[model samples]
Target: MTIAYWCVLASCLLPLLAVGYAKFLSSDSDPKNYDNNNPRDYLAKLKGDGQRALWAEKNTLEAMPLFFAAVIIAHNTGADQATLDALAISFIGFRLLYIYLYISDKATLRSLSWFAGLACCVAMFIISA
Candidate 1:
């Protein structure tokens, strides 16, 4: 697989990994440990630090489609490998950094990384267009 393909795969997996990590940290080893009594109960349990991690995970997952679309569109438009690789790498790196900073409750750093990832997507979109 090409570097771009690997970047896309890594980008997609980052959020799922974060969510798994968060669940592991919060819940006991038992898979059935989550309380299903109240809907908010589960979400509330993920508050503060856990909540941030959850949000970051959610955001990363949400961004996956747009990232894939941008890359695919770029490929279809005959975008150079270098440009695609650069954008893909930037998107993956920023997304990973964003998740890390968010899980650690580093607001400014997380936001910066999020913006950088978004900017890479925008750059790819523009080039593809």
Candidate 2:
């Protein structure tokens, strides 16, 4: 399979993995406790779900265009297999690291990971261009 294809697959799979991890992290309390009527309870649940969703949304917003741009540039400029693979893997790996750091609430580490992923995306586009 092509590098772009793999990147797309990874993009789709990452959010699902994040959701699963979030569910795993949730407390083993009664479902009634998740009710939307109570402001505090609802806010708590929203906070937890929002973190994961925000991370996924940010990743998706940043990654998709880069992935597509890489693919298009690769096709246009005849980029080599290794270069394409490296770009794809870098994007995926950095995104995973970003998710981990975000979930762990490591402020500095999360910021670093986010910056690294953004840099990787820019670098990929620059290289492809």
Model 1 error, position 71 (Å): 0.2
**TM-score to true structure, per model:** 0.82, 0.70
Off by over 4 Å in 2: 27-44, 48-58
The TM-score leader among the candidates is 1
- Go through the candidates in order and give each one's C-alpha lDDT: 0.80, 0.64
Could you tell me how far off, in angstroms, the CA of residue 54 lies in candidate 1 after the best superposition? 0.9
Clash list (residue pairs), candidate 2: none
lDDT string, candidate 1, 1-129, tens digits: 667778888887898777765665643322366555753456556666667777888899899998998888888898787988898998998998988898788999888998899999899888876
Model 1 stretches astray by more than 4 angstroms: 26-44
lDDT of 2 by residue, 1-129 (tens): 777667868876777666545444433323445554663454345455445545655565666676667666765776666776776778788778877776666768877877776776666567666
